[model samples]
Target: MITFESVTKRYPGGTVAVDALDLEVPDGRTMVLVGPSGCGKTTSLRMINRLIEPSEGRILLDGRDISQTEASELRRGIGYVIQQTGLFPHRTIVDNIATVPLLKGWPKAKARDRARELMDLVGLDPAMARRYPYQLSGGQQQRVGVARALAADPPVLLMDEPFSAVDPIVRATLQDELIRLQAELRKTVVLVTHDVEEAIKVGDQVAVFYPNGKIAQIDTPQRLLGDPADDYVENFLGFDRGIRRLAFFPADGLDLQAGIVLGDGTTVEQARRAAKQAGESWVLLTDAGRLPRGWAALSDLESRDGREMLAQMPLAPYGHTFRVGKDSLRAALDATVLSRTGLAVGVDDQGRVVGVTSYERLRAAIQAAEEAADGQGARPS
Candidate 1:
């Protein structure tokens, strides 16, 4: 929904913040601008809303040139978020969030209602509406900033290092929140950051900028990591790009073994026999509903006294286990890593144990994804 056509930004001192750049962010997708300091990633974002007018060429929103539109009107249609949140210290959270809506001539009641809705949408407590910015944590303030930007539900959002100032844990939470919000709202989003990992995690398409404000490459996160455009791009992605590719691997491609199963009421001897018959070291314990509860080792069952109960033995909790659908390879690999035997106990959404995927199978799945990506690249453009 946003397009930069040969756009360039230059200061009075002849410092070009953005070189002649041509970029497009498709409707309902995120395009991340990432690079080291002074790459002009942030400058490029500011130009979209005319926070900084371009020195050359034009920026188009949908089909019309934003340069020709009134600055206030243009900004109202595009949400802008910055790193520091920039909330008004004296205003309440609701009042801060309602700024744009209120400025646009919305009624006080309606604007505040919208503000409350946005706060809830961004995962903040509605009760915080009356609280001032100083009363909230940094993370809470950021969420309020996000709510303010999204108050009018703009189709386009410009986030300039919005999560950079927060702590790592809060940054991760915000990242997850952004991902979730994108899935639901599908706003045309342009996010700027120097962190390549963050770019990969949040970007549908990543634009790697160079020192002179030039774009090195713009491609999908998977393609950018799997096949970098140049040595600089490769280095920026780090030497561990191959390992990072594992996150994209699906679990369906892995071969799963038939799980050794036991009902909750099954006797210890019965469970032990089942484990031996299946030639497995552990048996999956399930309730009468056939939902997975935990796992029990064969040795533990053998050493148990006659009166001891299966539920009484030390059993690993359920949440620690991972479950993947029949088609997801990544989830299966994650489960394998968490499993004691390097084998993922595959369970359906209903929590019934379907099978188990071994580490060997996960390795094969990784190879398959790599080969597929390579094969696609080799095809004619």
Candidate 2:
């Protein structure tokens, strides 16, 4: 656990970076410090590893005063990752990951072996072990940096905008990877980021930093979204906070209508009759494997002269599918909005369609989710 007791960082020009801050990061959980630039979030992170000395107050690491320890010694025990991964350009991936372990007097073979293990742990292939940093992609290099941090098996990890340097797709993949790693390793993690969405995605608890090194609010991401502390925090969370809040609510038990679904083998006339019977303007067409094919409008089916194969007929695209057992309400709603038939397709892990949810049903789910969150006095974690 890390405890900040009235910690403050004052510059030589009498400017305060962090002012009278008090915070606690519990063990084996991720705590994300997030806010706008110059809000002192980075300063607070640096102070934890003594990269930036505090001008006032004390910081305790597992109840030991960090100031009493040597800077290099303290940093060696805590893994740190940054936006621009400071990898050694001259060193191979394995040597880079084994740097700290080698410095700490581990045998070269043992350190290299540990590096190989971490390479696999962070999703890097063994083929890249001998390659230099320049030979790897931006995402791959970031993985190497993470592997290097975990090479020594540090109990605490500090990350300052670690995924900010990558593209959005890669950034999201990295974020998920970090979450997966944290679940397996359970490291005490304090990550700093300006992206509120990223903080919400990865943090167990999020700290919203304000100007002058003050924390505006600190709470779980769901709680923070369900009930913002003030206008500033709410505005910083962006205008789509309500939609974001839905991400916490599971979509498993959502009521789905399968009556509107027809198989691809279903004839155009059969589809027309089924759509008329169900009173739906559109019918979802599925394949023999129960996978969603597309949507067939009732008018389109009716226009056909005879029993034309539904598979051969023109159909509206099925935009996307959400995993009913795995995805959230936000995903289901997104699927519904993207769909041409105004219905969201719920699928299992194998991408086979389970059923469809309408916009009205999604709205009811949202209301129920909000009411449940309110009744519990906190949103789902």
Candidate 3:
């Protein structure tokens, strides 16, 4: 556990970087410090490892005052990862990962062996072990940096916007990798990021810092979105917080309608008659293999056209399918909006459309679920 007791950092210019802040980070849980620039988020993380000293007060690592320990020794027991990676340009990937182990007086062969293990743990192929940092991609280099941090099996790990420099796609992948690693290793992680979304995605607890290094609020991601403490925190959470919160609510068990899905090779006469009989403006279509193929308008196929001509008419494309009993309410809502008919499609394990649901129905279902949960919470245990 990390405890910050009235810790403060005042620069040489007499400017306060971190005010007398008190915070507690639980053991084996990730705590993300997030805010705009000059928020002293990075400063707080540095203070943990004694990279930067506090001007007043104390920081305790598992009850030992960090200030009492030598900086180099303290750092050896803690792992640190930075944005640009800070990897040695000429060092091989294995050597880079084994840097800390070698520094701690381990045999070269044992260090190399541990480096290989970490490479696999971080999802990097063992074949890349011989390559230099310059030979790796941005994402790959970041993985090396992480491996280097874990080399000595440190219980505490610090990361500063480690995935920020990469593209969104790669960043997401890296985020998933970190989540996987944390599940397996459960290090006491303190990560710093300016991206609120990233903080919510990865943090067990999020600390929103103010300009003067004061924490505006600290809470779990769901609570932070559902209940913002102030205007500053609300504005930082963005305008679509309500919508974002729906990710936690599942779309399963909501009222869904089994749709009229006509398979391919069904004649225009058959489709027109089906649409008229069903009283639907559009008929759901399936490809030759019974998979969803957009929706065909009843009016477009109403002409005295033959099967070939009807096949040529454009079918409005639908959104991706939401799996019943699996996906979130947000996914269901998005699927409904993306479809031309404004109906969310639910699929089975085989990827076949099991049913369709309307937006109004989804909203009511969510409301009921919330009410039930609220009622349960109100009941005495």
Say which candidate scores most in lDDT.
2
User: What is the Cα-based lDDT of residue 234 in candidate 3?
Assistant: 93
Sorted on TM-score, best first, the list reads 2, 1, 3
Listed in order, each prediction's TM-score against the native is 0.85, 0.91, 0.85
Pairs of residues clashing in candidate 3: none
lDDT (CA) for every model shown? 0.85, 0.92, 0.87
Q: Compared with the true structure, what per-residue lDDT tens digits does model 2 show for residues 1-381?
A: 999999999999999889899999999999999999999999999999999999999999999999999998999999999889999999999999999999889999999999999999999999999999999999999999999999999999999999999999999999999999999999999999999999999999999998768999999899899898889999999999999988999998588878878887788887777778877888888999999988878888777865788888898888889999999999999998888789889999999988899988898888888888788765333
Give the clash count for model 2. 0
Considering every candidate listed, which one attains the maximal TM-score? 2
Which parts of model 2 are misplaced by more than 4 Å? 264-279, 300-314, 378-381
lDDT of 3 by residue, 1-381 (tens): 999999999999899999998889999999999999999999999999988999999999999999889889999999999999999998999999999999999999999999999999998999999999999899999999999999999999999999999899999999999999999999999999999999988999899999889999988776777777889999998999888777767888578765457777777888887777866677777776667777788878876575653456688876678987788888888888777687767887787877777877888978976676556443221
Candidate 1 residue 122 Cα shift, in angstroms, is 1.4
Q: If both were scored by TM-score, which would come out higher, candidate 2 or candidate 3?
A: 2
Q: Which residue pairs of candidate 1 clash?
A: 250-328, 250-329, 250-330, 251-328, 251-329, 251-330, 252-328, 252-329
User: How many residue pairs collide in each prediction?
Assistant: 8, 0, 0
lDDT of 3: 0.87
For model 3, the stretches where C-alpha displacement exceeds 4 angstroms are 259-290, 296-315, 369-381
